[model samples]
Target: MEQLNNTFVAVQAASRQLALLNSKQINNILVAVADAIMEQSLFLLAENEKDLTRMDKADPKFDRLMLTEERLKGIATDMRNVAELPSPLGKVLKENIRPNGIRLKKISVPFGVIGIIYEARPNVSFDVFSLCLKSGNACVLKGGSDADFSNRAIISVIHSVLKKFDTDPHIVELLPADRQATSELLHAVGYVDLIIPRGSSNLINFVRQNASIPVIETGAGICHTYFDEYGDTTKGAAIINNAKTRRVSVCNALDCLIIDEKRLNDLPLLCEKLKKNNVIIYADAKAYRALQSSYPAELLHPATTESFGTEFLSYAMAVKTIKSMDAALEHIQTYGSKHSECIITEDKSRAELFTKVVDAACVYTNVSTAFTDGAQFGLGAEIGISTQKLHARGPMGLEEITSYKWIIEGDGQIRK
Candidate 1:
């Protein structure tokens, strides 16, 4: 908790002086951070490996945060791309002329200090710093204890880069990885501006309920992709296959597949593709019966009600063969986490309609549901996939990390 206090103090100093720093200084720091990222890539990978090894025997949620060498290179690349993005702060959003002798301007500015409490993804150390710097905000990062050492190494690299410019290194600060310490800092709403809890549903819910600060809850990707009766069979199979099997452990992966009843006959082909990838198929009663008659009995079974809300996070999916689009929407509304959804179809009208009706951050027409990422959206790098309905909705980037303020510069214009 004391660590967060020191972080807050440093961030406050930076936030106060942000308006004085020109775009060149910010850009220079970004370039330097990228340089440092590339230089320290080897050390980051080694540190990550140590954490990854510990993840092997650890619990499920803890293990998911462990990273590898390839992932480390990707992180470095992500930072480089992020450094190349446009500055989000100090932008002229709007200027208004009032009836009186007053000119009001609503310009983009930085949120004072962002406090992020996230799980195993240690790369979030860079993500928060990159976005905060680009957005002209300061950040206090609290990583999960499971990857404390890894987080330390990553955070140190960021601070080291800041040191070159002789800037306050603690502008991108790391909170102590103690569970109780996290609560203590979270409750200090006066210290931090906003809280973004990016982890499990239970963890986020607790933070939202208990924290004094406002929270941006993200990471519950019990996402769904529907295959309408008028959908293209090939595209349906391909999209669902990619969404489920591409990287099963990630949040954007598809959890359920809704196939139209008229298209149930084609289930054999879809099931075959999934089976080849060793995906466990949980079929609703209709799909179970239909699949049993066409394919082997082992390929069919009645799905439980809880299966609809289940997030496999592995090479597995639960399929519900619906009769209409209304059923699809009904099921989704009941079980969907409102992260990302897809409608695999060639019909322009239906696809457009589905995109409009679906209440998700990203609604895809025929693309794979897995493409709901920051890089895919051309945002350089993503801090996290935010499911919250606030300032940020999807892949949180530099632009999303910022908040605007109405800066009124007046020359002693007193109220008459």
Candidate 2:
């Protein structure tokens, strides 16, 4: 508790100063941070490998945890891109002239200190810092224990860049990777402005349930892709393969497949593509019976009730056969995590209806669900893919990280 208090105190003391940084100053620091990251790639990779070697290669998080030269370059590119973007602060969203001779302006501003509790992905340390800095907010990062070494190295690089600019490094502080400190951080309502959890469903739910600070939940992705009766089997197969197998460990990877009952015979095309990549299918009884004759027994298994909503962060997906588009929609509403959902259909009206009716952060038509990302959306980087719709939804970019302040100018008027 004392440790967390000290960290929060440092951030609270520095938050105002951070918010005062002009766009040019913030951009310059971010550019320097990007250069520093690229320059120190050897050191960063060495530190990352240390953490990677301790974990099993078969683990899904390994892909997210390991940072290669290409990924490092990509990270550097993201930082530069963030620097080039327009500043989020000081944008006047609304201006009003009141009858009492008062001018009211609602301007965007930082959220002070944002506390983020995430797991495994060390790149988030840099991504969050860049977004927070670009938006003029201080951040207190609490990374999972697995990436301790990598995160330490990354933060060291970031702080060094901050020091070079004569800015207080406390603006991007990292909390101790322990449960006790995390507990204190969760309840530090006065110090932390908002909390965002960006990892497993269990972690997100834990923070949502326990935190005294306001939270924007980034729920786990039990994403789904439905193939309508009129959809092209070949194109649907390609979309499903890319969405499901492109990067299975990530949040946007497809977890469930919904096929029209009329197109049940075309299942082999999709199953063949999945089997080519060695993906195992956990199918509902209807889907299982339909697929049993063609797909190998090892590749097909009966899905239990528990499989419907599960986020299998692996090369595995749950399959279901639906009678109609409505049935598919109902099944998704019941089981989806509201993260990302897609529809593969040739009929324009059906695709439009699916997009309109499906309540998700990202709804797709004739496309893969894997494109649900901040960087992919050209927002540079993201805090996380928010599932809830209060403050921010979808990929939380710079604007999403900001809040508005109403500035009222009056000579001698008061609220009557």
Candidate 3:
């Protein structure tokens, strides 16, 4: 508790200093961070290897935790891109002049001290720092213990750049990887303005249930994709395969697959493709029976009730059948995580209906759900894809990290 309290004090003080920095200075720091990452690639890789050696290779989070030199370059590229993005602070969202000659403007501003708790992915340390700094917010990071060594190395590189710029390194602090300190972060309400959790369901839920500070949910992706009666089987199969296997250890990966009953014949073809990828399918009664003869018995299993809503962040996926678009929408409402949902259909009206009825941050038509990313959406880098609809939703970039303030000017105007 004492450590957390001191960390919060430093963060709050740094937020004030951060607010005073010019956009050019921030961009320069970000560029320097990118360069530092490239220069320290070997050091970072050595640190990352320590964490990787400790983790099981078969674990779902292993892929996310392991950072290769190529991945480091990608992270560096993203940081440079973030530095080039427009500054998120002090933008006038709206302006007005009243009949009494008073001027008013709604301007974008930072949320002060931002707390981010995440797991597995060491690159997220860089992403969160880039977005928070660009938006003029100080961050307190609580990374998973699994990637402690990697995160420390990455944060050291960032801190070096901050020191080079004569900025307070506390502006972006990584908290101790202890569970007790994490719990303390959840209760730092007055100090941390907002908290964003980006990891598995258990982690997100723990932060949501225990935090006294405001939280923006960013993980638990029980995402889905439906194949309509009018959908092209080839396209649908391809989309589903890419969405599931492109990167299985991500929050945006497809978890559940809904098929139109009219197109049940297409199941065999889909099963064949999934089999090639070594994907395990947990199917409902009907789907189980249909897939038994088509897919390998080893990869096919009957799904329990718990399987439907579960976010299997691995090669396993759930399968179900629905009669119509309405049924698909209803099933999604019940099991979906509101992260990313998709429909593969040639019918325009059906696609429109699916997009309209589904309540998710990102809804796609005839496309893979794997594209649900901040960079893919042309937003540079992101903190996370927010599942909640409060302050921010979807891919959280610099703009999403910022709040707004109203600026008013008057000539001695009084209200009665």
Candidate 4:
């Protein structure tokens, strides 16, 4: 408890100094960190392998936990991209002078110290650090036990870079991978300005329910892609296949496929690509009959009521057959996690309606839900995809992590 408290205090203190750094200084540290990651890729991967050996290869989190050389290179590239982007701090959001000679300006500022609790994904260590530092907020990371070895190795590399630049290493702290550490972080009220949980719905819910500090809910993508009667089979198949199988462990991966009942004949064609990937299909009665002739008999099953709202996080998907666009919308609204949703249609009006009406961070028209990413969205990289409609509701970039302050200047005019 004492050690965790000390970590919190040090991070909170360091945040003040971090926020005072000029953009060039911050950018230089980021660039050096990126260079160091590439330099030590082999060592990082070796440590990651230690964590991987402990888990079953078939676990959905195995993919997320495992880190490769190519993935390290990608992580390095994203850090460099963050370095090139302008800092989110000190931007003037609004400025005005009142009749009482009081000039007020709303300027972007850091959240001070942020606490992030995530599971399995060690890459999140680098991502959250770069984003928090770029946005002028210090972060305390609580990575899951599943990625303990990996997270430790990654944080060591980051600390080395921070020390090389003469910056306080406490600016980014990684807590012990234990339940006790999690308890401490959740209750660090004054020390942590915000707590963002990035992982499964269970993890996010635990943090939201327990944290004494402000919480920003992220992760848990029960995404859906709707196929309208007007949808082109070729386009729909390609889009759905890519969205579902491109990276099943990711948050944007599709979990449900809503098909217009009028397009039942097109279902087999729409699901043809999925067969090559050996995807498991859990279909409702209507969709079951439509896919029985085409999909693999072994991989196909009748979907239970629980299948519709599930975040599979695996090579499995639920299919629901609907009679109209309204039915499609209703099904999505009832089951979607509001992370990402897509509609593949040649009809312009239907596409527009889907894009406008679907409540999600990223709503797509004839595009794959796989595009719901920070780097892909051109925000350099993201802390996470925010699903709630609050301060942030999409790919949370540097700007999303920051808060604003009201700066007031007086001209010595006192009212009687």
Candidate that would win on lDDT:
4
Candidate 1 achieves a global lDDT of: 0.79
Candidate 3's TM-score reads 0.97
Tens digits of lDDT, candidate 3, 257-313: 999888888887866777888999999888887788889999999999988998888
TM-score each candidate: 0.93, 0.97, 0.97, 0.99
For every candidate in turn, the CA RMSD to the true structure comes to 2.3, 1.4, 1.4, 0.9
Q: How many residue pairs collide in each prediction?
A: 0, 0, 0, 0
lDDT of 2 by residue, 334-414 (tens): 999999999999999999999999999999999999999999999999999999989888999999999999999989888
Q: Write the per-residue lDDT of candidate 1 for residues 238-283, one digit (tens) a residue.
A: 8888898887878899899889999888877766667667776788
Give the lowest summed-lDDT range of ten residues in model 4: 407-416
Which one is best on TM-score? 4
Model 1 lDDT, residue 10, Cα: 73
Residue 382 in model 3: shift from native, Å?
Answer: 1.1
lDDT (Cα) of model 3? 0.91
Residue 248 of model 4: what lDDT?
97
lDDT of 4 by residue, 1-416 (tens): 99899999999999999967899999999999999998999899999999999999999999999999899999999999999999899999999999897999999999999999999999999999999999999999999999999999999999998998889999999999999999999999889999999999999999999989999999599999999999999889899999999999999999999998999999999899999999999999999999998888999999999898999989999999998899999998899888999999999998998888988888999999999999999999999999998899889999999999999999787878
Clashing pairs in 4: none
